[model samples]
Target: MTSRYLDYSGNMDGELRMPGKDKHFQNTEDRTDSGLDSLKDEDYNRIVSGVQNLCIPVSATPQDYEPEPWKVQNNEDGDTLLHLAVIHEAKDLAEEAIRRSYRDGYYLNRQNNLYQTPLHLAIITEQAEIAEKLLQAGCDPEIRDYRGNTALHIACQRGSLRGVGVIVQYSKFQLPSLLTCYNYDGHTCLHLASNNGYLAIVEHLISLGADINAQEPCNGRTALHMAVDKQNPDLMYLLLKHGADVNKVTYQGYSPCQLTWGRENSQIQQHLLSVTEKSLQYLPESEDEDSSDSESEHSDDEYMYDDCKLMCQGLN
Candidate 1:
């Protein structure tokens, strides 16, 4: 037994290259090659399939691929696709989007980062047809922007008679309230038209039931008051013709005729004077004089106190 063990150790180098070990190594190389070839085949199949798909003509309906309107918004300005479409005057795309999302109030009326809806941009861009489509699609007419201006307010500001007509025509039921809607600057659609001397627009708005005598919330100045302030005789006459209240006064109790006092448009001033009540023709002199006197007295007292303080400091 000792002789056999010693012989085995002595033959270690030769035993390592025995047939069984050589066979095992050969099998491993064959299996590795087979695995690599299988991987290559799979990769080739994938490449071929991708190319086939690219070359094949696949017919699909628009409804199958159209993205949800609510999900399509600009990352920077929060403008919906409809907003950009309207801005660029892409009538077809804008109309299609409107048709798809008209019933989706949250989408159709969605406001951008600037608080402008597609309807607002439509009128801003002077796309009266698009504005009409939006209105007909049930887009809200009274939605306000960051400046609290509705699309109708902008139309009036721009003096777009067509735009105004479209908005009013589609929003007939909301006309009474929409015409009186005020922006953050306290201007109704009628006020904006009057202030900007859009005589035709003013008349159209009035005929559509806009309040002729609507007053600005900031100063209680009526459109008539604004007309006189701007010295626009034509606008003033239009207001009068439409039955604007001449006696309607500002928060400070200054009537339209009173506002015309220093204006150079004598025609405006005299006409307003003719229609204004005699009692309101003159400014409330006593009240204004008393308030001004009190302010002057308070300022005088502050000045006297400061003079006295300086005198004491100089003496010290």
Candidate 2:
């Protein structure tokens, strides 16, 4: 059998290789290849077996087992067995991958070519159960992907409320900080949820004390602003009910009602109007009484001026 070497870069080469490429592969003198021949047959077999376990498709039911030795093997993309299992939606294999990592103290938070961990893959694929598995294995949900979005951010954008719940429940991230975390584009999880009309997620986030009036850093648009722009009455109602300030303006100085002008969103317009009226009703009584007294005094002055002008006209 030909002897092959797996490089740290995930490239496999035969004994004959270019000089620089062969640096990862070693001769009997340097022994830099991590001593492939020194390992017992059982250890090598276990390593190969773990790789094969990860190769199992998601549709098939894989038996539960720990792949302690599979740590040595990874595909060309730097994706470990856990990353592959999550990508393939292989629930059983994914669970086993978590088990192996936990038992052997392996890194489950490793990033792939795209800078995505297994948890990121799970959220992208909308596989809530698989995400739960990764969380259970103590994968860091706060890891940002190449797009600068955490798994929780993806969950909100993808409308995976269950995944969000799993991440919040299992991950050690502070809820307030995570909720306020902005992506590269200055969008918080609440902004994504509102823009996508994920009402349930929005409600859940609000219940968890997510800032209903949280503004995007770049545009200064709040969740209420997003709800109005999307013309989603239900979202508007939900946001307003949660105390989203309808009168709050964006960087463009456009309030939620201002954004509704000339649009076809009558329901949202009416809702904003109603909320605004109710808010106005709560104005301080001192201010209202002062305005009323000023109005009456102005009326009396106008009447006296009119009487004096009539007498002057009659004399003339």
Stretch of 10 with least lDDT, candidate 2: 53-62
Candidate 2, residue 193: CA error in Å?
A: 1.0
What's the TM for model 1? 0.68
lDDT tens per residue, model 1, 1-316: 0111111223322222223344212222344343445556578567544533333233333455455645465758888888989989999999998888755566678899989999999999999989888888788988988878889999999999898889888987888878877776667899999989999999988888889988776457888888877888888888888888888877667888877654588888777778789988865676456867756854875576556445533443
What C-alpha lDDT, on a 0 to 100 scale, does residue 144 get in candidate 2? Answer: 76
Name the regions of candidate 2 deviating beyond 4 angstroms: 1-69, 103-106, 277-316
Compare the candidates by TM-score and give the number of the best one: 1
Q: Residue by residue across 257-283, what tens digits does model 2's lDDT show?
A: 766755697877876776664433233
TM-score, per-candidate, Cα-based: 0.68, 0.63
- Position 97, candidate 2: lDDT: 75
